[model samples]
Target chain A: MPELRVDGVTKRFDKVLAVDNASFTASPGRILGLLGPNGAGKTTTIRMIAYITVPDTGQVLFGDKQVGPWSQKQMGYLPEERGLYRKMKVGEQLTYFGELKGLSHSEAVKRVKHWLDRFDASDWYGRKTNELSKGMQQKVQFVTAVLHDPELLILDEPFVGLDPINAEVLQDVIMELKEAGRTILFASHRMEQVEQLCDDICLISQGKIVVNGELREIKKSFGRNTILLDFEGPDGFLDDLESRQLVRINVRSKSHAEIRLLNDTRPRVVLDEALRHTHEISRFELVEPSMREIFVTAVTAQQGAEAIEV
Target chain B: MTNNIFIVAKYEFLKRVKTKWFVITTLLGPMALIAFIAIIGYVSISSLTSDDKTVAVLDATGILFDGLNDEDGQITFVVSNMPEDSVRKAVIRGVFDGYLLLDDQIISGSGEATYFSKDGGGASFFSRKLRNLVRSTVEERRLLEQHVPPEVFEILNARVDVNMVKLSDTGETTGGTEAFAVVGFIMGFLIYIAMFVYGTVVMQGVMQEKINRVVEIIVSSVRPFDLLMGKVLGIGAMGLLQMTFWAILIMAGVLLSGTVVAAFLDPATLNLPASASQDELLAAADFTIPSIEPAVFIWFVAFFLLGYLLYASLFSAIGSSVEQQQDAQSLMLPVMLPIILSIVFLQPLIEAPNSTLAIVLSMIPFTSPISMVVRFAITDIPFWEVSLSFLILVGSFIGSIWVASRIYRVGILMYGKKASFADLIRWARLS
Candidate 1:
């Protein structure tokens, strides 16, 4: 497997700058989660990487070779708006996609059978795509992406429209592919999935990269100021802490609350305050900010910066 | 990359060829056409023989009465001894379809005859038959009174027939003007129909890929231009296959009919004109099928391909630019106009294949495919003109493909917005 690199790529659509000097790298045997809010140029950046569209400036490379027809064969892209020929049989459609990626006819057929069996969809081989349920069609589409056994797999919003069971099944396969030494670039709005599956993260806001690094290092840089409180009592301490400017309440319920320390307030002070108000403290722990919180904070901060610059 | 183009083409071709619609159309289309022509022939022949009309001739010139009566014809002529008033009364009473009154002054060749019927319209149908009988009878009577020889009278009454033979640089061919017109019209019309049908097929195929949203996945693996070329070539191959099949069937039908007619008819008994040469008589006796020069077919195929490529690429571009079928209509009008105008010019071009309008139409790339083929069929076109027309068609197709592919690259990935003509131009201008 070869490493995939996108260096200083820029793209513009008419008057809009879709992506601005975007740069990122996905290493072999790891997952890189491309994170951004809606209309943050994630799809555009992914398209440039996938070679579906050329960037206005800069280049994308696989190992040492520039991304082009040759590199396209090595990269498997499952686009955000993915579909299969509705009137075509599952096996035939998969075989065609495989052939387009440079597989021999016999090899394509063999791999199509292997992938279909792996997905537990061997029974759908002879059925038209429209005859299958949406979930079933999705399984077939996933097979098209991996049938060629590409070195770099870019999946944009892969888990959308999937039930938990199917999503878990797909997640496991993605993990297996990573274990097999393939580089994966995953993009999604579902932050938890990225948090669980990605080794590296690149966050973009308004066509610009706001944060890019290893997920662990980025999370550590945000500081471990968030406290998860589990207790069985009135939650009046959360309001008191917030009003006192000691903490920012993120979430609150009758028996559980997530609180983030403000102004470098000590976790010990917050714990003592919680112990005084609650009858019983079952669990209280300091934790790093989640990917969702980091995403919102980074995006909002970037927007604020832009606002001030304007 | 070229390999990927073939792969895409194979998929598109096989997908359509495997459908039931393709099989049904390929097999049944020509059969339906044959059946339609047969029905038209049978209706016309039956109409001519089915009606029986009788007309009473009250001839004041008594010599005309004997020659006018003929019972074997569809319109039966009978000699009536009744007075003019009685004959008119009998015609009105439905005893005759009409009554013709000829006076003795007709012998001097200056007299006019009147025909009377309840409805005056039927006179035109049988007037020529009655007038010819009366004039010949009066001429024979005058000839006998002048003591002219009977053989000389026969020579004077002989009818002359003209046989049309087309002389060309290749030599003279015996097929008449009607054959030339028929072949030209058929070739031109077939090209016209094929451009529309196969071009629409290309458009629909592109629309299917876009609507299915499978184009993004396919384009990620191959160039958009390759996909466009693959689709057009694949569908065009199917069109060629079906057309070749139809041509074979038509040729076989012509040969079989010729054989059937030759087996049943004898040359000596046939009432051919005396002026017909031995070759014309033999050809008529054999009921020979008109031999179309192979060059006509070669040109037909050349023009069909060039014309199809030009139009299909434009159609595919239209397909990619719009998300919905209705949105394609405004874009379709400009492309469709030239094709429709070509058909509108077909009649006049056929009538005068060497006219300046025909020459201009054949030279223009948009109309050349149809116009040039028709002109080639009917007349001897200059070699330079044909070469120039072919070159222009090829050049236009290349230009169209370049523009269409550029628009298609940007349009296929675009969604949710209805693209207008201005947007298409902007896309074409994009890198």
Candidate 2:
């Protein structure tokens, strides 16, 4: 099992600090979701880990060894802007990439066939990559990234341009790879996918990591203070709850609402008050915050604090 | 790293060489040029050898007729007591190819002669021949009237040619300097064009890879420098291969054509005119082909390689620094300037190869790859200068590769924005 540790790595592109004091540890067999908005230093950090871009400060280590060309060989990276030789035949392109990754010629040929078959892309073997659909090309790119059986897989926005069915196929493959004990760092904007796939999460904003921890632990630390509620009653209860400051309505609809309980108010107290106003409370339950909410809250909070100082 | 370079180079070479266009161009390019030259030669020769014509002469001075015998049976003079205007009308009516008007003051050097013909430009060869015949006959008659002996007049009228031979300090004469200059100009120009053509191929290859976004995937395993070298060397090797193919093909074509032409023409046509000893004929035949020196050829290859390496690296660097094909033009201009300058200045170099301007330009690495070859062919450049030029060219080549590698390391990964010269310099320095 290999562990990828990024320690206080800083990278500056001209005057912009693309990655500032970014640090995280992805343990073996765990999927680490690198969560960030656009230009949040996600790609830069990944590039550093892949040894494509060197950090200005600090280091990235694989297990006990520092990441260099030797360690780079053990990693597979799918860049955000994925590309392949459009004029090249699918099988030849894969074989060429395999050879570049230091695989023997015969092994590269064999693995190309195996991966194509596994992806149900054997029919694409003789076709040029440009002849395939974008989703098919994505599948081919994925196979190219992992053809070497690398120990560490870094995928940046891998789900982009993928249709739902192909996305599901990729998700299953990533899960299968994770189960086989590969250390995977996945960056994506799809919070639902990250929530389902990742065991650990690192949320970066403005080139800095604001949230980094085990996914369950991070969620637990946020506390289960929000409730999922369903009711058939007057909608005036939402404003009434807001007026009392007993709960804040995070999401609302005609018959259902998700509310965050105030620090001093108890969920039961809010529920009792809601029952008095509504016709019936069919369902009410405390729930963990979604990754989207956590991400938005963390980034907004950081921005607000920074706003005050500026 | 070397292994990666070799692998990349092998791929580049194969990708280009296996293309149908490459094969067709390599095999047919020279053949087309040869065919074009042959057609032009055939047209010129046929026009020159067109049927001999009878010319009506209105020689007011009757003394001109007996002396103006036809030279080489190309023209037959028909004396007619007709007005110049009537002779011109006769010419237009196709009674004769042309007519000549000569007045009574012919021998006293106040004579005016005019040739009348339907086609102005087409009569140039015949006009020259007719003019020579009249001038020589008049001069011979003048010398005889001055009591000069006929033998002395004939001697005075004989044509003389200067034999130019290169002499060493020991008074040893080297024949065929004329052939050497011609061959040199041809070889030097070929190299100039080859460097421009194939060096662009290298640049375009880099640009293609950049445009395709394949550089990122490739630079991951192989170093950027390795990839760059592989591409440059691979493309350069392809250039060499194509050049060798053209050379052999052209050589075979020349040999085969020569034999076919010989077999077609009568042996008597090729035999020397019955006039002189065998030595003069052999000497005239010697002008047919210049003996190629083995040393000069070896130096040609060396210089070609050096020049290709120097320019190709610069071209690759420019390719990497640009964002699009349109951007390449502005960047390519500077690299192309020197090559164009070399060609523009090549005439002066060939005319006076030992001139100071020629020597200095040939010594500069940028221009030397071409100018030096021109100088080497016509004249004997000092051994030291040739070696020094070679050394400087190699040094610049290495320097270019170094600079190119730096730019390549940074540029291949950069996208979106077009990079300026300042940015390229910064990248070369920082990376």
Candidate 3:
């Protein structure tokens, strides 16, 4: 199993700092989600790791060795910008890519057929890439990226433009790869998928990393301050607690409300206060914050800190 | 690395060779050349060997045809003492291809005579010959009437012969400057056209890959320089292949034409004109075409390949930088300017192959591909000059590849924005 590490990497395009001191690690048999907003330098970091571009400072290492051209052969990169020879047949195009990745001619042909069949796209082998739908093209792109079975896979926004069914299929394939002990690093803004798929995460904002660690540990670090309440009868009790400085209601409806307890606030006191006003408290429990809440808060907090510095 | 280059080259060659346009171009060259030569040969042969045409000469004066002999092989005069209206009718009815209505007024200067024929534009070849015969007979009769000897007219009409010979530095002489000019112009023009055609093929090949967005994947697999060189060499080989086909076809066409002409011109069996000696006739009918020297042809191919490489690298760079076909037009002008300038100056080079301007242009990399060929064709160039030109061209070709690979490395991944010359220069500097 391979453990990949990117340490203190910084890249600049002209005067703009595209990636600043970015660092993350993906261990063997695990998936790492690289999260960011648009132009957050996630692609740049991935590119540097793939050896498509050289970082101005720092290094990317696979196992104990520095990443180089040989490392590129051992890795698969599906860049954000997708490209294929539209005039070439799917089988031919995939075979060419496989050969470029150092597969022998016969081996590439065999792999192309096997993968096409796996995806139930055997009939599309003879068709040109442009003749297929976008989703179909994306499937072929995925096949091209993973046909060589690289040890370290870096995919940028891989699940974009996919329907629920295809997205699930890709999610299943990615998990299968992880189970096979491949170290995968994927970048996307879709939190639900990332929360479901990733064992670890490195979140970046405005060309800087805001949070980096295991998914569960990062949520635990934020503390269990969220309270979900299912109540019947009077909803006015929720409005009464809104004036309390220690609690903030993030969402509220007729029978349900999700509340955030401020720093050092106890769950018992909040429960007692909620039951005293509501006719009945059907359910009340303190829970960890959702990934979406963490992401938005972390990014916003980082932005606010930088704004104050200016 | 070299193996990858070869693989890419083989792919490019095989793909283009299989295209229908290549097949059509290869076949069309020989077909069109043969058709052109056949048309010229047919027209000249038909005009020379046409049957005699008979003309009704309505000599109203009755004396115009008195001593005119009908021995001229091309025309026979038919005397008809008829009305002019009927003579015109006879011409229209096809009884005569034409009629000469010579009248008594024609002996005087006050009236005009008319020739009637279906062709109103001008006299036919046969009719012209008849007119010349009448004019000569009338002139002889007038000379005799003036007590002038008819033999004096013969002396006045004798043709003058001017023989031209070219003397080389070794005192070796050749007869025709005209043949040398034709060959030089043709060879120079051929390489000029070839440079543009094959150069643009490379440009468009690069542009196609760039437009399809496949170059980044290819470049990652192999160095951009390797890809550029592979494409250049591949298309260059194709150009050479097509030229080889043309050379073979043209040689066959020329040899067949020569054989046909030789059969018709068997001096021992054919009748000779009364005044022409065998040697003189053969010299006048010289059909031995001048050929390119084997060494010169070898150099031509070398220069052609080098020239294509030099221009194609820049073309590839330009192709990679542009986002679309229309975005390329303004950038193409600078790349094309030198080739166009060379063609514009080709006339002076051909006229004076050893001139200082020609010599200078022939040694410069940009214009050498064309000017040097013109120099090689019209005159024997010094060995040192040819070698120097070769060195310069080869040097520039390598330098272009280095610069082009730099731009190509950066430009292929860039999308949406149209790259200007400044951007290319910036990329070149960065790389």
Using all chains and alpha carbons, the TM-scores for the candidates as numbered come to 0.85, 0.85, 0.77
Candidate 3 docking class: acceptable
Cα lDDT of candidate 3 equals 0.79
What C-alpha RMSD separates each model from the true structure?
5.0, 4.9, 6.8
Encode model 3's per-residue lDDT on B294-411: one tens digit a residue.
7677777778778888888888898888877788889989888888988888788777788899988998898898888777867888778898999999999889889998898778
Which candidate leads in lDDT?
1
TM-score of chain A of each: 0.93, 0.91, 0.88
C-alpha lDDT (0 to 100) for residue B165 of candidate 1: 79
Any runs in candidate 2 off by more than 4 Å, and if so which? A225-286, A305-310, B36-106, B111-153, B166-175, B251-284
Alpha carbon lDDT of residue B356, candidate 2? 94
Off by over 4 Å in 1: A229-285, A305-310, B39-160, B260-269, B272-282, B285-287
Ranking by lDDT: 1, 2, 3
Give the TM-score of candidate 2 (chain A). 0.91
DockQ of each: 0.70, 0.47, 0.33
Could you tell me how far off, in angstroms, the CA of residue B246 lies in candidate 3 after the best superposition?
A: 3.4
